[model samples]
Target: MNITKTDVLWNYAATFFKISSSVLLLPIILHKLPSEDVGIWSVFSSIAALVFLIDFGFNSSFSRNVTYVFSGVNSLLTNGHDTSAQSGGVNYSLLKGLLSSMRWFYSRVSLTLFLLLLTLGTFYISRLLNEYHGNKTNVYIAWGLFIAINTYNLYTLYYDALLEGKGLIRVSKQITILGHLAYLLVSTVAIYLGFGLIALVLAQLISIIIIRTISQRKFFNADIIYQLQNCEGDDKKDVLKAIYPNAVKYGITSLGGFMIQKSSIFIGSLYLSLSAIASFGITKQMMDITVSIANIAVATFLPQIANLRIGGNYDRIKAICIRGVVIANLIFITGAATIIFLGTPILHLIKSNTNLNQQVLLVVAFSSLIGLNSGISGAIISTKNHIPFVKPSILSGVATILLLIVFFKFTNLGLLGMAMAPGLIDLCYQGWKWPLVVIKELNIKFSDFKMVIMKTDKPA
Candidate 1:
């Protein structure tokens, strides 16, 4: 098979393997830990995600720059340029220059920002822990694990940016699979030894650190380092300045997304019972696993789309966007059907409780529908650099929160209501608005876009 097809297959296979491992292991964890502890773990996970918001869009901004640089280098080589010549190597030098400057800037700005947020999150979590369980040690351990996980995440994002920019999805997949395997082993051992939540968190962090170290050595060797080192100061500064706006924009957008996804749990904890939070958390985790399959496809296509834009290839960009939407839809339909049919059995295998099963299935079904629709439009928005869409995205998130509050006050739908509220809003707003934005801003014919969806490529 050709390289592109191989990469696509690798990504899908890798995502499935990693997510499957997590799913398999999670039930064992839920069984081992008390339900209350499981609920707390869920809260910690969400808080850790919030820690990443401190990233200030650095990763997204860097990925776009990296992709642009890689594409420029490829274009030069494809056009029969002698890359070894001084001027031929100019673009590489320029890219490295920019990367180095941005890395320095990010290291300084992000470190301070992350530390501040970590402090705030730690204090907030501490208060919640005191109010809920009065367990200080677990809270401290949770914070420790959260820090390790977030730090490792920052490193992994850098590696991922490089891998995706270079179109090395297969290598990326290998790294991910290895990381997940390590986590599975650690989680299993921890459970067997009765180590509780700390074990799980530590295992996850160690797995990421090891995988990132190995991948960095394997894929990003001395040549890339040398390129960065040789970059001129002026060129480096220029790139950093150019990407600053994009980085901030992405950072703001990401915060909105984080709030939408995690706020439900936080709000549920405040307004509903802990058991309700656990039930809802389980459903959300399952939906995340299902959507991750589509995410692999989106990640693979994003760099390509960015490159197409940089190269002024609008037709191919639109075609890829539409095709991506179709693929996402099919995957979602398959996932939703399976969940609707077998969700109870799956939940039984994970948790022996019928109530949990019913609640999880309900949330997963709604989430699947919303995820499928949003995935396509989200891809297009990201590729089109329509950062302004973030305003509406935030609005959708706010609306979700408001609706959840109202539903909780007026209705007895409980956790299911909380889970479905956001999905309902996103399905109505993002699903409709993004397509219209794509058509209006990008000036692509809706019919042609639809044609790309109807056409099929070989399955990944």
Candidate 2:
């Protein structure tokens, strides 16, 4: 399969939709729902993210290994780069086995996620909602729908692995755009109809269904169908064994990363008022959107980066590092300033249920930028297939959570603590560490980085 220009273009399109859905959905949700209910919605979204821990990084790890199979590697490697000699053959049987492994894994995980979210997840939400005076019926209905959507999403997650592994990013992004449009349209209508929180999750259900169905049809073309049909035997266990080592590592790393990113929301809900959570969550969401917008190019090129690493193209990888950092810094710094200066006004214009203080958003901005830079470094390093920084990433999260607990409990910071915890810990290690590792790995000198920073290339 050949990569096309649209591969990158459609990725931007998909990001537009994702960010657009959030931006568009928010004004409506904040407008229609009560502040307390909005807080519950925030918690709901956070829990949805948490419940995905059940997938436990299988989808991403599977996708990366699937790329290896397609790259013509015969066996899964633990570390180091694959020699270029291994390229040029597509291992359809291995992919078939991987697909079988995916289905087998998802089946149990999906069931478990459903049961857990329906029980434990629901319990968590109920605890949050105990102080709510909003619409209980709608919240309950939305929770049920959220659970279902996640279950189905987990079950069919291989559609993503297949598309990404085959490097069909453009096609996948197009389908995603269509689904998100539907989500936006339906969700907007639902909110206008006063459906409240249920409206958001209901729209998501529709979008996921549309997106997954289209992906399944688009990916299983004639050649792939022929290969899968000819393929026999359930090699799920073999596939699991092949991917589990790094996959488990990635899971732990991801757990730490998720906690660092989300622990504020989770713990803040416990320590802060519902209204405070709403403000803090909304502010954090804005920061996330900024990072996502800044990250478009590098994120789209991840599979290609993997391919480059396997080919031992250190020069190209270094170039990507320079461009990614430059773009991320420029975008983040500009966006951060704009938001710091205008965020309150923008929130006001939309009649938002919550708003951000300049100081608070500023803390989040710089901290998030540092974390984003680390993320850029991590992305480049992981392309080399050895996760040397996994421990630091996990430790960073532990540190961030502990900081959050201490700040909220012992200080007068309150929502300010929620905003500062992740960023503060990130600055301590994650922000600077990963970039230094990348520099060391590539044998880059400090002067070269200085020149690279001073130089400007094409717009990322």
RMSD (Å) per prediction: 4.7, 2.6
Against the true structure, candidate 2 reaches a TM-score of 0.94
**Model 2 agreement with the true structure over 1-460: per-residue lDDT tens digits:** 3445587678878988988998888877777787888788778778777766778778877777777878887666666535645858876777788888898999999999889888888888888878888777778998889989999988998899888977889888999999999999999998898888888999999999999999999988888889879867447787788677776777777788888888888898888789888887777888888888788657777777787667667766676666666777788788778878888987799887776666777788877888788887887777666677678878988999999889977899987787788888888887788889888887776665665667643211
* Per-residue accuracy of model 1 over 1-460 as CA lDDT, tens digit each: 1137678888888887688777777778677777667777778767767666777776766666666566554222111122233322336665666557656765665466457647876776665665565356865786677676776576456666677666677888888888888888888898788677777887888788877887778755788767656754346556666666666777777776766667888888877666667777777776767777766555677877766665566776766666666676677668766766776676676663323556646665666566555655666566544466567667777887888798788998777777777677777767567667777755766576556666643212
Q: Any residue pairs clashing in model 1, and if so which?
A: none
The true-structure Cα RMSD of candidate 1 reads: 4.7
lDDT of 1: 0.67
Cα-based RMSD of candidate 2: 2.6
Off by over 4 Å in 2: 1-5, 81-87, 445-460
Best by TM-score: 2
